[model samples]
Target: MIDKVIEIEPLDDLDFGKVTAELRSKRREQDTIVLFHPSDSCQENLHHFIAGAKKIHGSMFDYGVNWDDLIWDIRGFESTTSLKDLTHASNVLFTQDNGKGPKIKVSRKDEVPFAEPFATFAKAFVTHRHNEKPKSHSNHMVAIKALRLLYQELPNSLTPCVSQLLPEHFNKAISCAMGTQAKPTLYVTGVHLTAIAESLDEYRLTATPMTWKNPIPRNYKHGGASQNRGGKEAKKERAKQLPKTDLLLFLAALWGTYEEIEERDKALVCMSIILLLCGFRMDEFIGLDLNCIPSREEYDKLPLEIDPETGTLARILRIRVLAKKKGHWDEKIVPHCTVDTIYIAVERLKALSKPQRLTAQIMLEEGKWNRFLEFDDDDYLTSREVKEHLGFPGASATNTISTLALHGIQRDPSSLKRKTRFRVGDIHDGFCDRYRERISPIINGFGHDELIIPIWEFLTLRYLNQYTPKERLNVFAEPL
Candidate 1:
């Protein structure tokens, strides 16, 4: 593998190819052997592993996809499966169908055994959840957090099993939950806990028995008088769940003011406009694919209609939106206008960043990020040169690019304390920015009326998307 990336090696005068060959000897003969990774403890950790599998991406991973055996270890231990592994990873990831999710922090401290009941129960509950269909990883994390919080509120003496949990324990945990999550979130957390508690007496994971009764109301949404008791302040908060008017008007003005903005900032302007148009969750935006929209031919197949009021050509473009975190589902949008606005913005944005996307494609295929397309690998470049290559010139650009290591090589092999030299191939974690074809402030384009762009597909194009009802989208959201 040609994977050794030198950070900075200066290029000086050389007359011909022969001259270059003449001085091709080692700059210093006192070199030592180095390994690719200095500190990873790999498969050697296999012995300490009790039994678990790496959470690999599944073939049956999408919405309506069949249950594949490889999707997870449904036996209920995949998330925290690395219990006894000797690898240096200090965290355990949440179980995910595709390979993206948050990780829970792990410690070798006493908390490990103390929290075992919660972790153990979480593994079972989540496994049971998968039996129906994969729950969103965000929801899974919330369930785990709920359990962890409940465990924390318990007395110091270690609870032997989940069945030992009591009513007072739940009350203390609900108090903690109220502080961190809203009523809806609290409700879901309560549901998961109740599910396990209800089943624990009969279907105990062990000989341990469950005697705890849930305090949370099953009718939480409408049980406002009983469950929602923060007095006037709580009522004020619930009344104001929608976004404030002044902030919203300021955002809406941005859509009309698009043409007046600077050319360099066109992409983000279009993005904010799309976000206003489509209520996307942040993760969904990042995982958007290039072919998110159907072909003109496919789109034409949808029932056609003309805009009678506008007296202009109108069509409902059935935009293909990727919900990366949430499983894909169909949504009905109302009176979304102007295919011209969305189609043009998407195409133009795609055009601008096509080069970066192609480069990313190469990076993905080769599993390497060694060199820029036109730059010499042996030549050294400064931060200024790199900044210029990326386009954009100013104090702000210099300030940002100056801090980049940009694939620079360090002087000391044993220590990262040494200064780094910049090279053309020194791109940072640029490849990790998903669904983006172009790089910059993303891409430049204009939008109008409505366009539901995915959050991640085009760094230029992504936005957090959800199956928002048309009414709430018009009302806007409260300050996040």
Candidate 2:
């Protein structure tokens, strides 16, 4: 009722003092007034005034202020806001909406449909997960999409107060998905369904035990490959199919075919090389900040002393990145040679601009960095831009990889050894395999004697020694 009655104050007539006083009076009378300001500065001032009011009112005053609504109002302002501000405000609104919980918009007549109670349960489930177990924005979106799909799939004849969701209904959904959808997609859908059932059971939304199992089988074929092949085997298969020569040819074509490749294409080439060598996820590569690379001070501190035994550079460059899978910040150190190559590539890309940093100004000059203007330099490259550059028509990472592989095949017919297609994951696997084959022997030899290994190799060998065995045995499986 308060949400329905509250009116947005005009930006020109906004008075913080008057609004705060009215809010306090309303609180004393056990009434609510949700105030909305169209200006960010005014909203900040109101927030401060409200804080001060709370201090004076001894914390008993109950005033409800919707931060999301205020942000929406600021965004809806017609003439004053810039496009960048509007985009940022829209993102903020979306994030806030997700935090509130899942919302289902149904008409009055269809409000109590067969899956109506499930919708209610879903809202509660999302709210609880949002508060207790936070997830990434992408994951949240997937959950919401899965719920919507489930709702649409349920039969209309079922009542709102249904006692159970039959297995046949789930089977029907799976059957409908077969041949039309990838196994991974169906698997993820099954996972979301299981999560929903478990949450409902946890919250006592269902009287019967809603112990739903994931219906998607692990060995289900997805594009001629089993989903259960695991990362190592899949990587090995991809590497066998995708010879290093193919990637090399693609790079050659990218750089040498044209007398003067566009600066953006050059940047793309550099990006691809770094991604392949560093085994970076697309998100990790794009998320890199200008400052994330070693600063001059940090570079000077790098161990460059030559090893007496190996007669090689004694240090490697450690580039710190926030890995998405780890859910915490971690560092990825590259060999000195790899670091040098990346530095050169980055410098060349940066040289295209006057700012000498990878900003929208530089990346967008060639119309390559799509949507880069909407974000700050600290954020990762937009998914849209990455997808566009990678030749992926769709938004999914899988699509990007698939398209990249297809493009590689189309561009260099002579380079590919097998008809089997390559994937983004294959790049990572190839890098790791090559590192093991080429660098692992040197490392093993160093271990045989009291050789002074370079710091990078030393660290790398230590990690491999400790983890590689278990990794092979699936002790720490990579997330699919």
Candidate 3:
């Protein structure tokens, strides 16, 4: 209720060391997002948040919040604007207490870059934008960030109220932003600037100049269009790029005669073909279930494509994919032309990857090693049930022992046959540098012992084999 005041406990001076140490660097550590907890007691209740990366620009950066629970949501406040000063902000916001909208948020009091009129306007604008029913939290930050950057760029004397923001201010922001920001970010700023500029038209200050113009040129591209447009030219300029057309052609040609290639290497070719056909992102493809493909009856139910050569119906397979960019479960269907080619590759990959999938499913459900492979720290690999654990099919018994040997898995002379040949505990914990090459979720180019990592890295991660590609080459000595 507006009648009641809300109090947020700030962090103690103990964090003063963290602030001082952080600021002492030649440049601000922009990458770190500081978590300030006001109520040091309960973690489940997340109270406030800051885009804490941007500290108060001047001497005020030294301040710290209560070291316990960081609770900064904008809805609980008494008045949105006409605040006397930043520090004079009223404590009227709370997670549980009810009355909402446009309250003075003490959350970023120290973080504001300006004084009086402009500072109040910035905080009020951030709070108001945050409560806009249509926008998500991320978009709320975009609006707040664009406003802050504009305020920071503008000269100190100009304290243009929220209703008085001009196109010129936006232009200045974009011009300065371009120097520090990537084009994609510039595009987002330009969009919110246009929206904000247009909204100010209704409340334009008659005493000052106003032009509701957008900073981004009408022709400037945003989102996917800009990314894919002229991508080939962009590709040439990037430090790492796909190989030349000639090289790609050679690879495709090599894969064309894949039967002639080693069976162990075919998985890579299969993954490539599957990706090309399905258009799944690397993470999406790798996370697929063994039964990802629908049965023939299911495909038959989908809209049929007419064959070009013959007058008959062709089955279409609509694959459900985890569409990350879209932030939802989505579906994709391969082009009819490559249906048969892709089917074979996917089926082959399924059979090859089956063992890992089985063990991975159980690990996924249990969040740990399955019963067959689970053991005490002193347990030795004395069970024949390892077929339930290892990326079972690709590895042979001999290579399994060799890989185990690489991890310091040793035989106990009192051991039995193949089962007790190696110690069990080390296989999960051991890190072998020579074979540090990890499988890429998209195109798994690296293969040694049929993806049977001694540590079973993918199996170890309980996220259903959401393997990430290695960002850099391993410098460890090569294994023969």
Candidate 4:
């Protein structure tokens, strides 16, 4: 066959295009392991593929020998390199081929890996020189099937050379070919092989004679000493609860010009106080509105009517709260005399009636709402914002408290502003002046209905319920 060029009709002489056209073309969109079959392979096997296109019927009539009729396993496999060498080797073997015999090919030195183990290397060497006859037809099919199954479970990370698969890997593959119906799925098996190959590669790269062991540990630890060496480990855990004093300094520096940035300053001060003391989620403040407060008259009204039964503050101011509960936002009201910090801030804003401070109208605009307060267009300040403001995140109440510590905000059982202890009446006066005295009577009057809103409903509608203590403390105790 090497000296004589046969002039016979090419295989295309037969009108097989129509039959081959019926076979599906196979191509890969990704590099991952997958199965492959020639375009004219069996229609039955095509339909049998787990994820094959459903349009092809497996039960269709089977006929003809065509490229499409050939199927091979290709999962986790790569094509062999140096095809030109193999073609030359095959041609040399074909020189002695008779009309009735199978063609032979010259085997290249590189193709020795394809031959079975224990085969004579000398015989293989000569085969490459003269080009030996092709192996029996049955042996060729078996080899093709073996190659297909091997690739399906082969790890992509492994070198493309077949010699890379270790003895254990080869054994497992052979078992897989003969294994039961419970065999691993294509993905699982392929992943396992890939993982093993990668681990081996990593091990090989790091292996050294000085650190080598015959049987390595199953569970290896990295950076073993550094993990437990530091005293800072314990401190790191406690840092979560410890207050962040630096935050207060940062905030003071940023918003010190309250007059220049009125609305934002007020919002920040109020939000910081609420978050620090109440431990409420930041979004809770996002929903607050003017109706969240009670009027000055109401604060002075006194819930208990002097019945002459007992001379007491008559018709005392009763505070109401709406809060979310049991998966439902609900309304709850209670009578109270002392005023809360939130009430004080609102009252101050009202009393100051400063044009710079945020008002009902200004806070409503989506774009303008965040002007004073630094926030994204979405109106949400992320934990990172809090961390950047302070040294840590703001999501936690504890963090908020520490942030205020630097600003002279004393934290303990009592409510105090720096060194000054506030009385219930003081808080009350503060609330009324900001809310009732300054707010137009018409506006204050209009807010009455809103004050009665259930805490849950209020919360849902952008209103918050700040908690108050049973009695207002007149002084701060340093140690007692």
For every model shown, what is its TM-score relative to the native structure? 0.49, 0.45, 0.43, 0.22
* Each prediction's whole-model lDDT (CA): 0.43, 0.43, 0.45, 0.32
Candidate 2 residues 1-480, lDDT tens each? 456677887888898667544533442221223222212243243333343333433222112223222111222222212211212221111111121223544333433222444443344344345434445444555665556555545555343322344445555655655645566777777777677665533333333335567767664443433644667977788778663887788786775543387643655676776776677776455445444567656786876766444568676566655465664456786665666676765555444322322222222232222223344433332333446543444445554434334423122233334222333333333333433333322222221123222212111111122223222211110101
What's the residue-level lDDT of 309 in candidate 3?
A: 40
Better of 1 and 4 by TM-score: 1
Stretches of model 3 off by over 4 angstroms after superposition = 1-145, 154-168, 178-185, 196-211, 223-248, 254-268, 278-288, 296-312, 322-330, 351-360, 370-480
Highest-lDDT candidate: 3
The alpha-carbon deviation from the true structure for residue 2 of candidate 2, after best TM-score superposition, in angstroms, is 75
Which of 2 and 4 is ahead in lDDT?
Answer: 2
Error of 2 at 384 (Å): 34
Expressed as tens digits, the lDDT of each residue in 1-480 for candidate 3 is: 477878755765257646533433322233323344222221111112222212321122122222121233322121221111211222222122111222334343333344445454444344334333324334655676566656655554455344334456777877866776676677787778765654333222212223445555433345444444466766565535545678668768867898898755667777676776677776556545444567656666777677554546776566655454554456786677776776677676656555544444333333333433547646666433343354444445665555456655565678777455444545433432212222111112112233322212221112222232221111111110
Write candidate 1's Cα lDDT for 274-375 as tens digits. Answer: 454555554433333456566667777777566454655556655454443334434323234645556555665665445445444454444234335565
- Candidate closest to the true structure, highest TM-score: 1
Which has the higher TM-score value, candidate number 2 or candidate number 4?
Answer: 2
Write down the worst ten-residue block by lDDT for model 3: 471-480
Cα error of candidate 2 at position 382, Å: 35
lDDT at residue 36 of model 1 (Cα atoms): 22
